[model samples]
Target: MKILVPLKRVADPDNANKVKVNAGKIETTGLEWKPNPFDEYAVETALRLTENGANPKARLGEVVVVTFGPKETESTLRQALATGADKAIRIDATDDQLDGDVVARALKALVEKEKPDVVLAGKQAVDGDSNQVGQLLAEYLGWPQATFAGSIKSEDDKSLLVGREVDGGTINVRVGLPAVVSVDLRIVAPTSVSSKHSPAHKYPEGVRFAALMAIMAAKKKPLTEMKLADLVSDAALKITYTGFELPPARKAGIKVASVPELVEKLKSEAKVL
Candidate 1:
């Protein structure tokens, strides 16, 4: 089974306080770049699905990682390679040149070319927080989709049983092969992904770290580069960011001595009552 995992580079979520807006665009200066947390989970899920057994050294199939960003984004792809992805493909495009729709279109084109059995992506990118690409891509490809997947099990070579998180409880659904799975946080858990080869084996919690040898090995792995326009000639962004303004500063909290006082404050000052 061939799995395609789409990744994105984002400002270090840990340093979100350092992010700033300038001239209507996000300023990257003084910020660190890292793979989107959810995308890392997607990569981990793909790796787990393709793993041979509890043995970390055995791989049953290929995991191909792809991304859309500028030259610097190669670092992100390299990281995925270090995590045991067989190959890396970088789509040359600037941050401003692409949006959710354009990315979905570009991925659709790639899917047609690569013909992977499964496409796994994060439920959303933290930077934009617009959870639209996976659904849009599934629509473009006319394939079944499982979104916000918390757990995934390969029922066979041709189907998957996906556990999805809903408002009240989790719902399980079966999807055929050649489908799209957008993963959520729980998908990174030890037993989140299972297959015939390793049905009962458990992976370590969180994304696996690459050993020094794997890091060096990734340097020799195939890394293909392509222009975004070459893949989707008429790609156009359907949304525009006019400007950005920081949210209002939070106000300090006040203490109420009793329930009646709290109700009085809610009615008089907070005005929620």
Candidate 2:
């Protein structure tokens, strides 16, 4: 079974974030980039499945890691490759403005070319936090979508039994081949960087430019592009971006010295029962 894993580069959650003012647009720059934590789980899950020597699916073919980002995204791909992927595919966009529709479009194009048995990605990307790409991609491909999968085990050579996290609890699901799965972080723990699997360090200084070239080069590396028309035989889903607004800053709360004072404040001022 050929598996395709999609990864996204997002702001490292460990750092402080500041919005940048760029020609009236808020630019998220100067922040460090890392894989969406949930996508990392997907990658690790793919590796685990492929490494299951005792299972027949363990003999599954290549593990391909795909990403769409600025050239800096190559580092993320290399990280996946170092971790365990057999190969990598990088899609270069003019800019990092890919929304769920565009992402699904691009991935749909790629999937048509690769025709993998399974596709996996994170439930959401930290930067956009839209949590819609995987579902959209599945829709575009006319594939079964098992979303928010916390754990996946091969039920048979052509089937997967998945543990899906839900609002109240978890649900068990079974899906056949050629399905899309959006993974949760608890699905798999990522492999740490080690000497045996260190990412490519010698990247160019201008990563965006380099990444564009690398995407062009990706055509030679088992990559293919699909046109917008080919992506949707019917009316394509309407996708648009309207305006951006910053949320109001949260107010700081006063610290009370004792539980009694806190109770008094809650009862008298905050008006809680």
Candidate 3:
């Protein structure tokens, strides 16, 4: 089983306060970048699916990680290699040039070349939260898709039983090979993923950390760079940002004199009643 996982780097979500709107665009200057958290979980999910938890170093299958960004994003791919991914691909492009549709188009091209049995992705990227790529890729490739996967059990190399979390309760779907799966946070839980190679094993609670030796080795692993134009003939963006603005500041609370005043405030000021 060969699995492809797409990763992305985003501004540190913790420092969202630093985000500024200048003119009609969000500023990206001097902001710290970290791997999108949900994408990292997807990477973790792929690793678990490809190896036995007891013998993680001896992979039963191949795991490839890919990303789209400038040269600096190579660091993100390297980090994934340090985790356990066997190879990495960095699509050379800037954030301004790509959106959900463009990404799906490019990935479809790459998928043709790589021919992996499965594509695993995060349900959404932290930066945009679009949650469109996986479904779009599946549609473009004419493959079955399962989103928000909380658990995955490999029925074999050819099929998967996926558990998804929806509004009211959980739903399970079985998808054949060559499918796309978008995973949710709980997908990283200890028992959330299992494969035929790792039957009846309870993995540790979360993604595994690389040892110092493995980190050093990751620097030497293969990371290929590909031109975005080479993958897709037309790299047009369907979504455009017209303007950006900071959300309105919260107002301080005030004590009302009586129940009537509270009711009046709700009716007139709050506008709920």
Candidate 4:
């Protein structure tokens, strides 16, 4: 099965506390970039789907990763390539020049060009937290979609039975080939994926790390760059960011001298008797 996975490079989530808001926009200076955690999960899912459970090193089919950003974002694609992706495509665009709709439209065009059996991505980008691209892309392509997939089992490379995580509980749905799937956090679990070529086996939890050899080899792998305009004519952003600002700081907590004092504070000061 051929899979096209879309990835994004976002400010390192670990140092999110260091993020600052100025002039209604986030400060990108001195910020580190890393693959979105959820997108990383999607990459792992694609890798697992392409290979058998026992011999994962052998690529049964192709797994291509794509991203939208400037030249620096090539590093993000490289990282995915290092892990297991066969090829990488970097859309020449900046964060400010695009939105979810434009991204979906561009992806739709790219998918048509690549003609992959599946287009997979994270449910949302951590920086924006707007989970819209996958659904929008599915809508534009007029393909079946299964979102929030926690587990997936490939059946003869023709269809995938997906276990989706919902509010009440998990729901199972089967989508035909040439579909779109947005995965959830649980997707990286040891037993989250099952390929038709491989017997039942458990993979390590979380995204797999690249070996030194693989890391170096990734540089030699194919990396393609496409202009944002080449893929989509209407690059006009549908969504605009006016500004960003940090939330107000909260007051430090105080220790209560006794239970009665705590009760008093809760009743009056806290206003929750």
Question: Considering only N, C-alpha and C atoms within 3 Å, which residue pairs clash in candidate 3?
Answer: none
lDDT value for candidate 1?
A: 0.90
Each model's TM-score? 0.93, 0.77, 0.92, 0.95
Which ranges of candidate 4 are over 4 A from the true structure?
A: 256-268
> For residues 173-235, what per-residue lDDT tens digits would candidate 3 score against the true structure?
999999999999999888999989997678777777888888899999999999999999997
Question: For all candidates, what are the clash counts?
Answer: 0, 0, 0, 2
Residue 76 in model 1: lDDT: 97
| lDDT tens digits, residue span 1-273, model 4 | 899999999999999989998888899899999999999999999999988868878999899999999999999999999999999999999887889999999999999999999998999899899998999999999999999999999989999999999999999999998899999999999998888876477988999999999999999999999999999999798977788889889999999999999999999999997
Per-residue CA lDDT of candidate 1, range 14-112, in tens? 988777888777887888888999999999989888886578578888899999988889999999999899999999999879999888889999999
Residue 192, model 2: lDDT of 19
Could you tell me how far off, in angstroms, the CA of residue 230 lies in candidate 1 after the best superposition? 1.6
Which 10 consecutive residues of model 2 have the lowest summed lDDT?
A: 192-201
Q: Where in model 3 is the C-alpha error above 4 Å?
A: 254-273
Top TM-score prediction, candidate number = 4
User: lDDT per residue, candidate 2, 87-164, as tens digits?
Assistant: 787776534345678778778888988888889888998767889988989998899999998767765438777888
- Candidate 1: residue 191 lDDT (0-100): 87
Error of 2 at 28 (Å): 2.7
Greater lDDT among 2 and 3 belongs to 3
Ranking by lDDT: 4, 3, 1, 2
